[model samples]
Target: MPGFVGAVQIMNIGSSGVFHIGDVFQLTPISTAKTFAGAGSFNTGETLTIRNHQSATNTFDNDGIDQGNNFNL
Candidate 1:
């Protein structure tokens, strides 16, 4: 079976996000990060694939890093 979309409306697609209309084989969203005052070495990484798994099979879940102010400045 198939479907149709008459109209699509999107207000805001914030940083490191995705917006889709119809069907898609694969999607890779952008990544973003924020740092406090005088904080350095802010970085982020992502992959839509790994091993024999399909790209769509790799979702963005349980992906993050530990942040703190205990670091020596």
Candidate 2:
């Protein structure tokens, strides 16, 4: 479909980030982040720790609602 987008400023974008100005059929995003931290430096034998070691399990079902609906401006 016909579309127009003006000026846009984005600071940061993640691993599964998406930016759309006009129309979109389906936007299914599955994102995960993990971080480990420690107090002292690694040279001092400070062990890195992870508070949460869990994983991500995601599922999606896009039934093709807006599959094709193209139009003019």
Per-residue lDDT for 1-73 in model 2, tens only?
9788889999998877877777888776655444344433233445666454564443343564433324311
lDDT of 1 by residue, 1-73 (tens): 3568797778888776778767886776645445343222233456433243433333344656655334322
Model 2 score (lDDT): 0.56
Worst 10 residues of 1 by lDDT: 35-44
**TM-score, prediction 2:** 0.34
Q: Cα deviation of 40 in candidate 1 (Å)? A: 25
Candidates in order, TM-scores: namely 0.37, 0.34
What are the lDDT figures for the candidates, one per model?
0.53, 0.56
